[model samples]
Target: MSLNRRVFLGTTAAASAAMAAPMVMADGHGKPRVVVIGGGAGGATAARYIAKDSKGEIDVTLIEPTRTYYTCFFSNLYLGGFKDMNDLGHSYGGLAASGVNVVHDWAVGVDRDAKTVSLAGGGSLGYDKLILSPGIDFVDGSVAGWDITSQNAMPHAYKAGSQTELLKAQLKAMPEGGTFAMVAPPNPYRCPPGPYERVSMVAHYLKNNNPTAKIIVADPKPKFSKMALFQEGWGDHYDGMIDWIGEEFGGGSVSVDPGAMTLTIDGEETAVDVCNVIPAMKAGHIAEIAGVTDGNWAPVNAVDMSSKADADIYVLGDASQQGDMPKSGFSANSQAKVCANAVRGALTGSKVFPAKFSNTCWSLIDTNDGVKVGATYEATDEKIAKVDGFISQTGETAEVRKATYEESEGWYAGITSDMFGAKT
Candidate 1:
């Protein structure tokens, strides 16, 4: 509802310190080495926090293919033309300054028995503890005739980066009165409210640039997160520009015909000028190889985010299964803090106290109009339960809406600052 001043201060200090220090590498030898695979929301946050809290006691090595990460949280704003890549993009310079060894490489697999991680560069990294937060991988066969190749033609844009750019470009290129269709993923995936939020943002773009263009959503589930609120917003805000087909309308068989650029529903087919398909997903390959994911996601002890598969391993972000908690960036960021504390405690043999984790996910229905839901959580031996939380009530007041927007921006700054920044 409001800015978190305490966390914001911590984040700012870490970022500032990182900017000051340029070349920091003492963890390669000595100290417990924590190899964090992935540099997205989960890994970045964990690495920065661990390196900061451990005080050079734990060497954090973050393996990622890219040095920069564009926040999927605000990418919808980019789609709406309210923001640019720079507004969403973040770098790992702070982590480097905080003593995190940020490696630009893809993690291929893991030798759990030996506690080694193999990279794409034909080398292996040994770690005393491994934090796998590689995020999700699209399931190839979930949709018929849809794979990575097909996606190039009709982008998913789900994982951010180039694919997101492709989708934005396509939207801009489409002529007036053209069609924009989005295929929503089945339940239990990243960003539950993302598709609808995307719909609103895209519709906002079309409403001004291509007013006659239509936006259709093909959903696998009959219901969705904030369904009532989204429908209300679409109806009152965009009028007839947006349409959604739930399970009853789509027959629960979600597939895409990439060649035709068509979506099949029940026995009918509808063509679209641009298609965005979000496929089913699972833990990243490295996590799967390490036997961290139980089925689709990695299981962890919420108290510390340590992997159930191995004591020396931890998983966070969308790759890990956090029941009752939606798979979202906020969840991942919160989990990172818990994981960082645990890593510190484990290495120092200090008593690690459980903490109440918090998360708030804001979805931009339009630039000025948005919705947010947040919860504070606590973990017990049984499971994670919400301690306190609230969603922006439907038809929120002007002040509340504005505050939510400010909070969202603050969250972005705070999260990125925390992840890349060092501990103060």
Candidate 2:
């Protein structure tokens, strides 16, 4: 059955109660329990949709440590002063109101054999289905001379929130002609266009405040998402202020000294005021503890995002190694809906539609100058294969770029509302 808001709202309460009656008799349990770890775009959306759509047939528990979640999607805009931190921050009150049990605690471990999740607060939760969407965590020692301990001096700022604030503060306090260095990550990381957009935002900040400040990027990849668009914008907007060193130019061989405030590229060390080091990433620790991850990521069935390692445990967002789709907030949110439908169907015998997914990544280069890349996908036996795609063109009119930026604004507002309820 096609699930829509109107149909869901019009369904009689007696019908929903009848749908839940079978769950009680089948398992001798009051209701099938769904435990979701992570309260970001994926997990929050899944929990909300399952609870809202199931209509008391499912017990949805959301386990997230943070009360307020700051989105990493538009954080680059925050660095560029286009948005405020408050604009990116969302609370879990809406989820709780939507019939989800919002548990503000860390998920320390998972027992697949017993179908349970152990919390850091010394409690264990039993689940009929478990959804894992724990974004990303840094791969230890991925960058030489940099670790979690050095985060204060050289912030990664990849996770958003306080780290983003810290990096912005460092930029504001830079000397007039200070140098800003960035160590970009390798392929298959969260948001392919992220680090480059960050460069643009950083340049925008420095152009107004510290015009003479220099920005340098050392990237392992030969080319990045929206490479042409970003290169054009950098040249047109912030000429001679940004330097991008790719793999061909020894950009791949890099290291940092956070204490000394130095970055080494190709055996040459340069002193800098601030360093943004985005190391290689992996699935969050909880996914590994759950034994769902392959290497750095957890592989999932493209059809339902159920973990390949275990059927009952599903993975979503940056942590899942679903093919083709980039690890993006939009991708995660899209995947969550599909996963929610499948899980709800499996438990309550609801209609499950064929999986279809789509994603768009928008980046702001300068004021009213935004660009985006996006794609649509379908599930195959092997992967989530891309069906078609689109990207913002180079040399577009000023009006077009402005419209794109405005579209992103609308999307940000709509997505936040979708994840957290409208009242939020």
Candidate 3:
């Protein structure tokens, strides 16, 4: 039987009004629901892509407590005043406008059997599939006498925003010829090249303001990402100001006294004006609570980033122990897209493409001095394996370095747009 209804015979304007969907499925069936935890590089991109690509066929809810998401990538530049805090801040308004349910609340727990997410704001959300990209949390006791309580005195500033500002203030207050100390994290940490770039930025700042001040780095790793490039830059630009002590020289065994403002490295005590301690990190707390993590990090199937423990949940970014990818924002965003495509295909019967991921980490040595390393990856049965890669050479012309910096700036804009769906 066919039913015909009279339509508007006269045309007034070509327009359509947006309609709201229920918090849960209301079509008398279990409509697919995707709950994304975290809203930075990984989570935001996953949510937006799932919602947009599904054409609102799937219910997407993004759980992030903060009203604005601050990026950690260019945070080093902020320390040098090359960019300000505002430049690192981004809003989720655009993602909301794209039909994603943006919830500014923490996901306290995930009941995998019940398929419900417990929220910190006194509510619960049900999901057919869950995406967890909760980023990183520091490991206590990794740095002796340094914990959340002492963050103010010896700021990590790894998460960006206020901590970055705090570290900058402490740097400004350093006395003439005073020392600034850094205890770099071990391997399998977020942003492999981040600490080195930060050192460069600090060197740039100190050279301009307090040229007499000195920097001491106690690194657990023997060699770091972009080592040759950074070493070359330090020797060329900040000669005689920066000293790096690697693991062979007792950099790995370090302890700090926040109260005394003293750092003990290789059994030698050195009083310092400021200390930045980046402790060992693991997946965020929620992953452990959800029982999806294997101790420190969540292991996932490389094919689609599905949890090895639960097929209904997927983990992305720094929280996931994915192979051949550093825990950087670029890596997270790349992984999110592949996961989003897989999740969308599973729920909506869409065609899932072959998973291919790539990442590039760029470091600013100085204003126009920049270097980068990146690789393309393919998901094998075992893990995501790197196919090929490239890195900046020890000596590059000023033109090439400037070009690399500009490329990084463009990438920052592009990635933020990719995550937040903003025209910015």
Candidate 4:
């Protein structure tokens, strides 16, 4: 199904009275309250959609710690110097104007039995329905010799804000022939193609500026998303500059010394000027606190994204293990729409259509050189099963690559608008 603003609005209107299920009233409360945690693609989009479509019938509140949200998508472009920091930043004012009560604060805890979310600021918010989209948090001790305290020395720019700026600064300060190293995360991490794209972008910067700088990637996984295409681009654009050590070469056995600025792979130590360590990830702590996560991620029903542990609670984005869909911003945004529809229907007796989802991930290798992989999905009793998919080929024409890059730029604009509204 094609998902767009017009289609969404039209479908919601037409389906409003089609459901025979009883409306879940707010139990003497004036309005059915929806509390959404995390204000990235998933939470923000879900809040905006619920508020926009509910038309004052439901109350929507979005909780986010940062007033200026930086998108993880396209952040590698910022490292490649294709975009500035401001380019990735967005304000929550637009979401507020769209009728979402945008709360700027951290969500400290969830009281599942009480149906309340406690804030770090010493208050709690009750909700008829709760949506958790807190993104990913690094798993402790996933990478030896590195932890949150060592972040300054070995920056994990995966969160895409201060860390991104820090990494860029370190890259710029590197000496002419200095070494830059990355310890790539294992599979089932956010943005499957993200780490490789970062390697490409970092190499892009080094090739233009440092010229003789080297990049070493120690990957636990044997292969990565768009591996063939990334390898071809590395040969064409950054030959001899990137050394990727996969598991076959003992890349999985890796450690780093932030204090000494040293990287060890397979018992071979190498002094590196900068190290980027992306550790294993899990659903944000709130998901675990809410008692919805079986392991690292929260498992949800494919049809409505409701947590398996609680019918009134939903999970979205990287935090959700809904099956088939990769943890990406595009996937989260798509899931948010499906979820908003279901939540609205459950709360106000609105029509809820069958859930359909789609996601496309775009990566840039060099200047105006882009590639993508995407799939369509349908909800099944078991999971969100993939239906059809497409990917950019290894040897595409320059025109095609350039067009792909332009298409990504457009998508960035469109998705940001979709999540944050008309940029107030």
Candidate 5:
């Protein structure tokens, strides 16, 4: 359903628990220790919730490599020039101030038996419970003839920091009336509406700066999240400027040559000024290293997001295949709260609430033109199934679209605050 101000306020209040210092456990050993292996939406929120709700009964340590976190959610707007680099960047100092022992380092390994996490810099942290939210890593050979080494030429701006800057620069440098091609990923990737939103942002930039430039999308999936809404927006705002070739129309047979800057869809090769290869992805490296992944993603109990393989560990964000979630930042944040509640209860005998989830994904088609699709979920035996949903329909008036855009702006502010604690 639509994410209104009331919902935003409620979500914010849930995460706004007052910070407290670490307290000793009943057995006099120490506080129940919880180590989080990633510092994005999932990991950070989990750490915050356990620390705050447990009232310092849980000692939380968040391990993230980056000092300054750049959000993947609003990154597309930066490429569209609606926002700048600083606008998308956040500091972990706020989380640190919230009593999370924020450790800046890579998590190299996980010893399930020992209940320890090895850091890239050496040494390990002991944990009674662990949260893994390492985000997505590209699947090797998912996109034909593309690998990590060739990323400079055909950048995947999925990570939202350096790659985003690279893609934006490449997009602006395209020749007048030149072609910009994107190789969209298959299903179950992070942010289902992400690739299309990127296309919209890129078009927003090109339409203003280089109106004659064309955009082409070669996708492996026949349909995508918010397909009808996105298609309708494309037709209304940029009818002739965008072309999408889904799998039924030769997208599955697509290949790319990074060196030559050429994309082949069904044996027809076209040279493009820029290529963004959004390859198929899986849970980050640490999930598999921890031996928690079933195959590609870490399977979790939908009730609490605990790893089905190991109860001591939990998986959140894009890394967990809990069912029916689109793997958006909002979804990860929602899951983190449920996870935090369960973790706190297990550690401190705190009150546990029934698990419920909600996610809203907002996309900007052009200036002040936005649409969204979202749902509320319930935990069932099979999966976390959708209870009810809503979407921004076509043929809406300009005022409604602008209001939708404003709602998204409010969400971005609310979620980031919910996620990182605060700016200062």
Candidate 6:
């Protein structure tokens, strides 16, 4: 996806909806109130899809702070200087247009016993079935000296929007020959391949604008998503511009001094001119407070994303533990469709047709040169498992690379269109 903001909101009608106040859905006759928390990739998609599929039987209420959402999927383009931040921001106007109630508020906590969600404001909202897709929250104590304030010193840029902009600005402001350090998180984090893809993008920028600059990855894991292909691409393409520190090479773990722009790994400290720290993550704050997360992520039944702890609640996105599925934007979008059908089934009190899902995540090695991984999945009684999956092979000819590039664009158009295309 391009980093041009225009793509997020395709029409002027969406912009006008952003200017309006919050829309509330009344539980007419006290129908099932499905309160969805967080309005990003998963929650927003679920709310819109469930509301449309249920045909007014389910009272859909979405709790989120922002009217506009910037996607993490394409924010790397912005960081790599290929696109602007505007290209990745999405608006909630489509949900409103589809008859889904979107409230601009932060969900502080969920009162599970009382069945109410406490908001930052003085109000409390109730729900019959709560769909929690609040995404990932940084795990404390994973990186020493890196708390909220320290975040500004070394932006993670994992969540996108302002943080992504900050990372880009810092990169632009760095000296021509400066080093860029990316501390990649351990496995089971949002966008498994994202950190590596990010370094590729950063290398692309440095190669063109600051050839003397270097991109270093401090990785916790020895292997990563499409590791072979990424490594080959980096070595053959960016080559010397990109350097990686695997688990055995003083790269796996991290300790950071944000003020110093320094990262310590394997008992040795390494200084960098710029840093992007992606810490460990769990379910978002709201999900944690609601007693949904077992440790870091919410445990859900694979068949429908229904929380194992709560009957009516369903978890999706990076927050939910879907066995064998990597947490990516495409995964969240696909999970939403599955959750939507489950919500409809529960509301109607009948068995629904089986659901199968597919996800494709495309990362740009450079502009016009992209790599992709895709999987088609089915749900068993216990967990979601991949039935088929493939990654783009390394050193494919230009023609094949071009075809995947176009395919990537086509997938983005189709997924976003199908996701946001639904009427409120």
Candidate 2 stretches with Cα past 4 Å from truth are: 1-28
TM-score of each: 0.94, 0.94, 0.94, 0.94, 0.94, 0.93
Candidate 6 colliding pairs? 3-87, 4-86, 4-87, 5-86, 5-87, 98-423, 98-424, 99-424, 220-252
lDDT of 3 by residue, 98-155 (tens): 8788788889989999899998878689898899999999998998879989999999
Among all candidates shown, the one with the greatest lDDT: 4
Q: Once model 3 is optimally superposed onto the true structure by TM-score, how far is the C-alpha of residue 252 displaced, in angstroms? A: 0.9
Model 6 TM-score? 0.93
Task: Estimate, for each residue in 1-424, the C-alpha lDDT of model 6 and write its tens digit.
Answer: 3322244335423322433236454443577888999887788888978887788877888888986788788788787777776666667777777767888889898888878888887678788789999988898877666876777889988887889888888888889889888888887899987888899888888888888998878887878898988888888778788878888887866778887788787788878888898888888888888898898899998888899999888999899987878898889888888888888788867467686877778888876788888889999888888999988887798777777766766665555545554222
Candidate 1, 1-424: lDDT as tens digits: 4565446444355443333232233434677778889888788888887887777777778888886777788898889998898877777777776678878888888998877888888778888889988888988788776898887878888888888899999999998899998888887888888888999999999998999999888888999888887888898779999989888877367667899888777767888899998888888888888887888888887777788878999988888876567788888888888888888888877667776677777887765676788888998665556888877778787676667777788777777666666332
CA RMSD (A), model 1: 2.7
Worst 10 residues of 2 by lDDT: 15-24
Task: Give each model's whole-structure lDDT.
Answer: 0.80, 0.89, 0.88, 0.91, 0.88, 0.80
Worst 10 residues of 4 by lDDT: 14-23
Question: What C-alpha lDDT, on a 0 to 100 scale, does residue 196 get in candidate 4?
Answer: 95
Of candidate 1, the 10-residue stretch with the lowest lDDT total is 16-25
lDDT of 2 by residue, 1-424 (tens): 1122332133312111111111111233678999999999899889989998899999888889887899999999999999999989888767776677888889999999988888887868889999999999999998999999999999999998899999999999999999999999997899999999999999999999999999999999999999999999999999999999999998999999988999999999999999999999999999999999999999999999999999999999999999999999889999999999999999999999999999989999999999999999999999999999999999999998998988888777667667776524
Residue 328's lDDT in candidate 4: 99
The alpha-carbon deviation from the true structure for residue 365 of candidate 5, after best TM-score superposition, in angstroms, is: 0.4
* Per-candidate clash tally: 0, 0, 0, 0, 0, 9
Per-residue lDDT value at 399 in model 2: 93
The residue pairs in collision within model 1 are: none
After TM-score superposition, the amount by which residue 171's alpha carbon in candidate 6 deviates from its true location, in angstroms, is 0.6
Error of 6 at 123 (Å): 1.3
